[model samples]
Target: MNRILVIGGTGTVGRQVVSRLAATGARVRAMARNPGAARLPPQVEVVRGDLTLPETLDGCLDGIDAVFLVWTAPATAVAPALERITKHARRIVFLSAPLKTPHPLFQQPNPLRAMVEHIERLIETSGLQWTFLRPGMFAANALNWWAPQIRAGDVMRWPYLAAPTTPIDERDIAAVAVRALYEDGHDGAGYVLTGPQSLGQFEQVSAIGRVIGRSLRIEEISPDEAQRELLRIGPLVAVNMLLNAWAAAIGQPAHVTSTVAAITGAPAKTFLDWATDNAAEFRA
Candidate 1:
């Protein structure tokens, strides 16, 4: 693919993909609702596009050979948005979850999962080459769940401390995505990506504290209390889905995979490595 477009370019993983592709001297374009404030690499073009508004995608997909799609729009927009994408781009790399994995953590039914399944079905039948990157718990999620508490105090309170997850770094996810977008032999691939090892929520928090040079205490709270506190930052659906998944994940080792290292030819980053790199985000 000579030229590529990245939807959701301003997002955490999307920005990493944009930066990596631009550094490789690939012709890259990023789609944002507000292109003026996208703040991506200056060498790449930033265009205004919205998945919900299908008409806005035409200009973004113009003359593009492939796309990196990080979809967060409503379910109502899935069909329409893909319709526009198929008209221009022949290949797409979708940021998806491990829907088919036998692990109980991902087997739970949720609104988000249902929508992703629908999107996948549509893409599979649309006659376009597609690659799905199904990543597990993201290491960046720690910044959302514990950053404020760690920045303010020494004690972080959370439930399901024993529940484990293989937290993949966003950089690794983006690296594989870039390869899928540009390289051959990746079409029809469904990669279940994860970190090198499993770590519990408490262990992840402690890792962050270690990186920031603090001996932070982790307090276990009840599920109800945790839900209330978390709802302040996330929607009810997402919050409940996480609580249910974590509760189901107890007493089970998380599912880890070597797909990231296999695809990128480098060892998958550990949770400690992610914490060390993002240590400043947790500092006061």
Candidate 2:
């Protein structure tokens, strides 16, 4: 059995990865700051770890063959963490940000960009195999942002109701990550994964409505209103980051890619498909 370590294993994508890997009988370890709260399967070894301190990973890397690395913080310590992993692991699947763009968010002045670039450089020269999975907006994010409103009523009020996106399913993203971690073909590859089609936020809300047998009304609000409402309910930093990203995508279409289908041997899931799959999460 191959031993794999998943960082950020308590997150939306990481939870799915750990679940899928455990179901398939892989020897998996989930590393996070709060391992006891991760709720991983009994088969998985949950270890307390932090990205900021790579030395804490020493005992956890014993016999670890591969890693699925996801950054939860500003990524200031990624290089050190990679150094620790490269010492033991043969392959690494890194969850990449859309910071591949040239905007200020991805520029040299950005701490996240610097961290991502540093890790990429280190992995490229480490003589170890690497794959980078860069996924667009997650369909799961809709649940986090809009599910409460959908559950409360049949009306969804949000900004960018017409903003288009190829919202990839986090489960599909994890599936590809697992393949890259365990398989042989993805070495030195960076995949831009997206959903099967570009759908606007309104369309996505409507899809969820259709899945749950309701007709939902989408009311588009001003960006200022959205920001104010978000700050009141959402995590301050994350909400601000998303507001910035949406501002950047005001007119430009979100990039849609074939990489998910190409790597997974199946068309990327539609938002409707995803909504149907997670219908229970949207119930009133």
Best by lDDT: 1
Name model 1 segments beyond 4 Å from true.
none
- TM-score, model 1 to reference: 0.99
- Per-residue lDDT tens digits for candidate 2, residues 30-94, read 99888778888899999988878888987778789998988766566767877899999998898
Give lDDT tens digits, candidate 1, residues 1-284. Answer: 37999998899899999999999999999999999899998999999999999999999999999999999889999999999999999999999999999998898999999999999999999899999999999999988989999999998999999999999999999999999998999999999999999899989988888889999999999999988988866998999899999999999899999999899999999999999998889999
Q: Which ten residues in a row have the lowest lDDT in candidate 2?
A: 102-111
Best by TM-score: 1
Q: After superposition, how far is residue 50 of candidate 1 from its true place, in Å?
A: 0.8
In the order shown, what is each candidate's alpha-carbon RMSD?
0.8, 2.8
Number of clashing pairs, model 2? 0
Predicted structure 1: clash tally: 0
Candidate 2 RMSD to the correct structure: 2.8
